[model samples]
Target: MRLYIDPGTGSMLFTILIGLVGAGIYSARMLIVKLRFILSGGKKVDMNANRIPFVVFADHKRYWNIFEPVLREFDKRGVDVVYMTASPDDPGLQNPYPHIRGEFIGEGNRAFAKLNFLKAGIVLSTTPGLDVYQWKRSKEVQCYVHILHAASEATLYRMFGIDYYDSILLSGEYQATDVRNLEKLRNLPAKDLVEVGIPYMDEMKVRFEKAGPAPKHETTVLLAPSWGPEAIFSKYGDQILKVLLETGYHIIVRPHPQSYTAEKDMIETIMKKYPESDRIEWNRDNDNFEVLRRSDILISDFSGVIFEFAMVYDKPVIYTAANIDTSVYDAWWLDTPLWTTGILPRIGHELNGLNLPMLHSIIDECLNDTRYAKGRDEARSEAWEHMGEGAVRTVDYLMKKYRELNPAERPDKEA
Candidate 1:
């Protein structure tokens, strides 16, 4: 009796059988937690425990955008917000919570603060080392919201961003949809994702609503370029400073913080060369978005600042990817034609300007181009809708999660 299972049927059967086995394994693991921890551990498990956390992550930088709001929320609730730091010598360590000033606590104990938060019905997380360091405690009802300390763009940035939180705050739908399809979250279990727009944009919005007239004779342009495989400095980067400064434009050389050393040296050399050029200024300490809010134009590389500027400021952007390797850089920018997608696919502008004359011509043409200005405005409108204007929406959602639960019901931190 030859009861033959065809190869195709055999493969299908094998797959289904494997799936069942994997499911069985997960089911067994859950059963063990319930039976061993809850049933056998025999300690009365508080079926209801407080879980709304006083949110802030390790070594919280004081100047962060969300600092004030998070503090206000915790104070209203009578909970202490946690802050960790490596610099004990840092002046003015005044706060309601215990500040653990220690060597970047070893990974094993990095989440040492989480236990404290869990005891207080809260979980605060930031950065790669801390996110993975804790969360293994796995308090099912705990609220774990991640307030990104910085803005995100590019597919690669989000992909590398998955390891450290319970919930994510997205800038807008493009970012949400963009992130949803990203290959990075593919491995992550589905969790809550929030699209409340960026928190700092809220700060930008307040000033804009009370918007006063701009300073006459002062048109500030921020020169921001990425710092990586194809940094602006490698390309016609210096050309921007020389052309804008030599002319009469108010140029603010706000390069990436990562370019601190290079930018410093460049600024020193340029200042000596152009002592009479007071029209251009250098401001590194300004909030990035605030600078974008005031800028008349943005000269950048493949930085997210371009998308933000295009969407928010609706201003002309002159990009010089001349130093970027065709093999590596993604040529798809917000709306203006990219060199890779058959959208004006080949620009031969120099990426550097160390005594180069062509760079000046490129900057002049871009600043003066009517078509470039129109495209920038159009792109900004689209980005504004996509990014949304409410940074408070993210905070509101975090608060909503708190209101839904009984704080007294969250699990207490285990000793």
Candidate 2:
């Protein structure tokens, strides 16, 4: 007799087994620690090795961009900020800052959530699900503020994980609406939702304004796609490139950081097939904003970068109809009509099939056509209410939260 197993089934089983074992180990460790405490005099664990007024936590270095502008604000205000991470190799820990202190809090879900003594007056982060799931110690900080990294729709954002945050900083009206709706749906308390635009994009706008005219390049098309089974690369990776190359347009294919590993085999195969040429470049660099800055237009599938491109430069974007695999992730996002709620439809021309002529026509329309121009501008304005001065707003909000937490510490008003 032979046993048959689907690859997906095997993978799921492996993940479940690992998760169970890890949970068991963590429970046992916590139990032992508690027992030791009861056996002896009630002694406190010193997880708060370096407690600071402002503590910022990140899951990995990739999220460092979210904290960059905040850190700069902290520096300017002469406020010392403590940076903590669960990633052992986060390079942000190495970046020297006079007002910022860094610490690598080890790795794994247990280490990430076992942080009980790491106390702070005001904690701020873009990372979701902080100290809520991996461990039961959720109230490790006084005030927790969540900053929005992506300006996507409601259900697409983290569900219960976001609820744990005391305050949420939103970039646009869409996010604020989502939070309000989620609160009503879940019967949860109204969170302190502030409409502070994304900090990085605010900086991007300033940089773009200060910099002279972008260097002229032959009409360049950037193919930057999100990582998944239904990504542009998985659907028609090489075919898209082939068509673009034939059209005499410069092509830059920038894969998501995870895509290089998640779909390594296919990505490598495509790169090998089409070696680097003057007309094509495979971008491995994680910094895609520069790539977006250089490209004439963007070709993407359901990536948040679409909002960044359209809202910032007012450039045109060509998007593939999102091909989401419900089995892999959230089903609710698919259950609801995301396109109807979000500004995606208004900003870009959505392409369904891989028809070359249709694709070419859409690209042309994006470049020169004025049919959707007004709609795009209107959507951009509505979505990014605080378009340019997001960092300032964020800094102001953080300071207010800090003051609220430590009323006595705030300076007294003079007569």
Candidate 3:
């Protein structure tokens, strides 16, 4: 007698509702613009005439690390950038940057409403799915630039995520190749793809260097998984943790930030099942560098953190076999295997149903093995080119495109 809606249906309905609200807001704003033009005695009005030159939109505070270095570069060069975020308490809002003006633009549909009617010369963002979901292209905005927040494949995003962007700043050349291939497959115009290494990773590297070496402690295993139906925790439940706990090694469980929100029930159930104790710990720090530095081994499932731990900390990773539904993502369009999955064997060992029981032995093997060192070096080169100069390169590309869009405002020296 009870009607139930599946997650897919619920998500579709929610997206539709947000789209309707955004369309209504857009219509209202357009009406106001028309009225203003009419009141000016039939004179044409340029909506973007008073638009800001550069804008950076951060949908969540988690991406502040990625945008911080770029904004710092803008601040250093004395270039003005509007930092708009949906999170009211975003750290970016409190950054001590003179040239970067930060503002909290509300969350969800409200944020979409403001962005849908945005007026700007150039807008750079780490958030994708622009023009495909609630966030639509603004007529007044000249260009939309997307920067990679992770050192993974660009095609890993949801279907049509980067397809609508004017330019894409990549972490590696291989990602650019994937983008170009996708464009060709979709018959879309080529977007400007600049290989600008991982900016946050660069920041992490600096922080790690300054922190010196981590003090000696018990061998720790960090379980950091992505969130969603295909995530390790979602698919395998507490089975993975059960096996790890039996290993008698100290364990640090750091669920993806979204897990606390999107998969609340699942997370709560798991946490209740295994309460924190001396041997087990839960980590939800805003900055993961300290925790990552302290840990020796990482266990993850398709999360970008695998690359972070392996490349940044030079640690071993034990990846789980989670068959992600690529049909719902841009990966479906590609014939080649994912670079993340392909590189896993080289950087870490696989943990699946068969190996679940041998987790402890596998952990011992990974700790004792140093064979993946070469693969990690190769991955770093292939996935993160121009390592130490990410922020500078990112700002250079954004400024170049800005100058191209606004020739009259071109400065003598690029930022």
Q: Which candidate is the best by TM-score?
A: 3
Between candidates 1 and 3, the one scoring higher on lDDT is 3
What are the models' TM-scores?
0.60, 0.81, 0.87
- In model 1, how large is the Cα lDDT of residue 287? 56
**Candidate 1: count of backbone clashes, pairs at least 3 residues apart or interchain:** 14
**C-alpha positional error of residue 205 in candidate 3 after TM-score superposition, expressed in Å:** 0.8
* Candidate 1 to truth, TM: 0.60
Off by over 4 Å in 1: 1-52, 58-63, 66-143, 148-154, 158-160, 182-187, 218-220, 226-229, 237-240, 262-271, 274-276, 286-294, 307-314, 322-391, 403-415
What's the candidate order when arranged by decreasing lDDT?
A: 3, 2, 1
lDDT leader: 3
Candidate 2 C-alpha lDDT tens digits along 1-415:
9999997776556456545665676577578768877776888754433446788888777778778887877766677887887787776688667788778887754454444444577777776654434522334367788887775543454446677778988867766776777677778889898988778877767777776446987888888888786778877767777777777788888888888788889888999998889989988775666787788889888777777787776688888776554452222533354533356667778765556546666677788867556756876666666776787798788787877776756522220
Q: Give the clashing pairs for model 3.
A: none
- What TM-score does model 2 achieve against the real structure? 0.81
lDDT of each: 0.49, 0.71, 0.88
Candidate 3 accuracy as TM-score:
0.87
lDDT of 3 by residue, 225-244 (tens): 99987788977899988998
Local error of candidate 1 at residue 123 (angstroms): 3.7
Could you tell me which residue pairs clash in candidate 2?
none
